[model samples]
Target: MSSDDTHVGLHPDDLDLLERLGRIAAVVDPVPDEVLELGRAAFELHRADALLMSLVADAGAAVRDNGAATASHLVVFELGETSVEVEVARRGEFVRVIGVVMAADQPYAGECRVSLETSASTTTQTLDDGRFAFERVPVGLARLVLDREGDQPMRTPWFDAR
Candidate 1:
């Protein structure tokens, strides 16, 4: 009766039972689309030596009396001694993102390139005075990635742009 001494095979009934369990679980507790998207984005490949940034602050955007959204959605991300501050603003049917990179102990004066990535597209901008901006960006799950010459790359966690 020891299975280690013989070859084992799954019966057709076992697969049926597993499928039934999966269906039941799906109905009882299904995974949210947002969670699934974040999970996928989190697993996307980046530089092996890249440092992952942590989201430190996220201030949601405000709505005007006419139901129009205004800018000033501030989001901050940090890793090690470096931090990135971002502002997300709604521009008509799109969004605008502006960011600045900073080092806690000193001014960031390196040649840095920032990229705003989403499931659909990616937009890149070179830092001007440690700042960058992306206008007319699609509204969806997005993230920021920074690459500096001769330095470790950094990336922020995926966030909703809407």
Candidate 2:
């Protein structure tokens, strides 16, 4: 090997074949730079958006639900100048959660979505009077993300989900 010489221990035909294959693959199934950037951003957003909320009431805690006999969970999370209150209850095998996102003086008047850890598309709705609900959600890890008008986003901690 000399400073100006460059070679690998492969036949010339082999090198040429490898180069052609690489070119073919690139054209056949190319990953664009924009797609790669989007993928990276999506992953970062998942972490950055999961703004874990503090649990005020845990599952199985003694909580009354509108004078109902069924068991229920009451969880609350307070963010700076904003807060979310969630009540988890069983409608059947699935879970139903009624939640409200309130602020000290500026409640969110936008959309709220419930996402399960195992899901991609989520149950979404525009927050009406600071209230939202998730119906027939499977029993598992779930979180709530709020998108408010003219305000930063907020997400709740993963609840018992059931």
Give the winner by lDDT.
1
Cα lDDT tens digits, model 1, 3-91, are 22122485667666876888898889999989988877565864446688999999885767477656558899999889998888875
Candidates' C-alpha lDDT? 0.79, 0.66
Off by over 4 Å in 2: 1-50, 59-69, 105-121
Report backbone clashes per prediction. 0, 1
Q: What is the lDDT of residue 109 in candidate 2?
A: 61
lDDT of model 2 at position 80: 73
Candidate 2 structure quality by residue, lDDT tens digits, 1-162 = 111113357677767787788789889989899997886566446748445556665656544567755557788887776788888886445677888888785656655543334243366677777888777766666777776555556677666766
lDDT of 1 at 81: 86
Mind sharing the TM-score for model 1?
0.68
